[model samples]
Target: MAHADWSDPTPAAGWTIAHQIAHLAAADTNVLIAVRTPEAFDAVLKRTEAAGSRHADLEAAAGAAKPRSVLLDEWRSGRAEVAAALRDLPTEHGFPWYGSQLTATLMAPLRLMEVWAHGQDVFDAVCAARRPTDRLRQIATLGVIGRELSFHAAELPLTTEPFRVELAGSDGRTWTWGPADAEQRVEGGALDFCLRVTRRRYPAETDLTAVGGDAQAWLDNARVFL
Candidate 1:
């Protein structure tokens, strides 16, 4: 599968399967560097920015230079290394991310979210269907937590009032956040909520329903990742 169809473009912004894997591999490498040698990670960021190079551009260039086998091996090995580094770190220890610092625990979930989201792109490229998993609970939780950040990103006023989030998990369990009787509420499948917050799917494309002004506003401008 890897050798025969590496160049096939996916539905995700028309990125090839190799490009999707390359992005994950590159990101995992950066996380490993951030955990082990923060200065090196910072240097990479500075150098990339100085050269006017986006991370996507760098990932594509690197992927294009390597064989499909090499890229897959790197992605597998790099992710293992990142997992090990995160496990070895103290729970309270924090490391630099794109702009902010995140503890090992926080970083781990973000990594999972990236892999799952990008995995969907790869699966779609190969005409494969992936059933949703309970791991989306982590993503849905992150989306709810990022409500304020989303508002800030959209250049909208932050609502101080809390909004309830109720999502049905893939396993049929309900995940609820915020007040039980809040006037503003968002209710839907966990996958839809995660996809919506990640900007993978527009609000209109999902079955998620937003009630009240604040909840509707959040649904319109949700972004779980930077």
Candidate 2:
């Protein structure tokens, strides 16, 4: 996985480390609404929206209030609850998301990826780097979800076949997913790969390999929603 212990200062001036941590913590909490009540998952959607607004307020106020340690504790607790929900939800259970049904087990990694990706925002606020790992493969695998989202949002037809993603981390282990000879192949360091999908790194500024026409463009506008 492409994991990191990053601690660089976030470039978003209004956002502090505490605010980033709290936003992710809040997002994790919002994801859980889908688990406890599949029929009530619309509430989950609304909650994420609410969380975003709340985070905006928190980011603005972060300059004035709260202890760092206390904020960290709150963030940790919120993450724990999300982890528990991800671990406990059964495979047979499904949640409503954007008019679709998603099994909890399949959705767990998405939740994990969200935490790991957003966690980088906090890490950047402190100027640190985490160790690279195999877990990044799991996270980047979600990039396939991007094609669907792009097609939906841009009103263009995009292929759904898995794009081959290969990463050679700073540690030298090559982590890969999908078939090597697939229509598209994306190669880069674990950090860059994660940063790309998370919309943190622009392809030109990073050592990313995107094969096939419009592959990079596909990635450029890739968003989580349809």
Pick by TM-score: which candidate is best?
A: 1
lDDT of 1 by residue, 1-226 (tens): 4444888887766478888888899889889888999878888678667767465766666775689879989999999999999999999998887778989989989999889888877776777777898889998889999999999998899978879999999999899999998999999999999989888789999999999988899999998875
Give the per-residue lDDT digits (tens) of candidate 2, residues 133-159: 677766666765566676667776776
Q: Which stretches of candidate 1 lie over 4 Å from their true place?
A: 1-4, 51-53
List clash counts for every candidate, in order: 0, 21
- Root-mean-square deviation per candidate: 1.6, 4.9
Ten contiguous residues minimizing lDDT sum, candidate 1: 51-60
What TM-score quantifies how close candidate 2 is to the native fold? 0.74
- Backbone-clash count (model 2): 21
lDDT of each: 0.86, 0.65
Error of 2 at 77 (Å): 2.0
